[model samples]
Target: MKLSKKQARLRRATKFRAKHAEKGVERLCVYKSSQHIYVQLISACGTKTLASASSIKEKNGGNVVAAKKIGTEIAKAAKAVKVTKVAFDRSGFKYHGRVKALAEAARDGGLDF
Candidate 1:
């Protein structure tokens, strides 16, 4: 049977996560919606969140610009908490457009992935 789009995306996410888990590094996860973009830095053990940021308060939360802002915010938060390295987890979203912009912005903000 063919999977639905959401199911397909989730499948890909699961596969990527399995590989990431093996490295046991902190995870930088990104989730985007129609009106918001959320990011989190999860602990290496996967039991806690070290830092988080979102675009909920932005005038246009779903755009690339908002995503970039959120990325910088997350990077700053991670630095404040002394987290400099993490594995980027795009959550199965294609690394394009807003996702790409966010990743680049985070890099500029001093997070190493």
Candidate 2:
């Protein structure tokens, strides 16, 4: 079966989610919109959001610079919650541009991907 680009990505994402579920580890899911980035640490039990960051105005900054800002925020927030290791979930988006920048910033901020 042929899948459109977006559908293919979603299909790919489903696999990652399944593995993450089985591993039972906190997950760092990244969502990148054309103008914004969002990240969340979902609990292993799948019952709560451990931490999150985004391009929300209160956080400001939405470009590559802004993505970096959110990355830092997510790292700090995760640390505050005592989370050090997490699986990086790219949601099947290609790892470049904003996504890459955010991951790098998160690494710089002390989150092990």
Candidate 3:
């Protein structure tokens, strides 16, 4: 079977999601598109969103700088909700470039993952 790029990425994502689901820990999920990046802190049970951040208003939301900003924003939002730990779900995106910047910024902002 030949899988498209998005389908392959989604297949990879399912493996991580399954593990996180079983553990029932809060998850910080990230998704990026050509025009924007979005993040969400999902509850342990996965039924609710605890916090969210994005780069919709940034001048160039697809860049690393914007991703880093969104990361810190999400961390601050988590702190306000009193959550310090979470599982990072990169949604099958390679952990480099913008995604890497976001994760590092989140760590710097005091999120433990």
Choose the strongest candidate by lDDT: 3
Compose the digit string of candidate 1's lDDT tens values, residues 1-113.
99998999999988888898889899999998989989999998888999999998999999999999998999899999999999999999999988999999999999999
| Candidate 2, 1-113: lDDT as tens digits | 88899999998988999988988789999997776788999998778999988897844455788888888999999999999888999999999888889899999999897
**Tens-digit lDDT string for candidate 3 (1-113):** 99999999999999999999999789999999988999999999999999999999999999999999999999999999999999999999999998999999999999999
Q: For candidate 3, which ten residues in a row score worst on lDDT? A: 16-25
What's the true lDDT of residue 55 in model 2?
90
Q: Against the unseen true structure, what C-alpha lDDT does each candidate score? A: 0.92, 0.88, 0.95
TM-score of every candidate: 0.96, 0.92, 0.97
User: What value does the lDDT take at residue 43 in candidate 3?
Assistant: 97
The candidate with the higher TM-score, 2 or 3, is 3
Clashing pairs in 3: none
Error of 3 at 90 (Å): 0.5
Question: What would you estimate as the lDDT of candidate 2?
Answer: 0.88
Task: Rank by TM-score, highest first.
Answer: 3, 1, 2
In candidate 1, position 48 carries an lDDT of: 96
Backbone clash count for every predicted candidate, in the order shown: 0, 1, 0
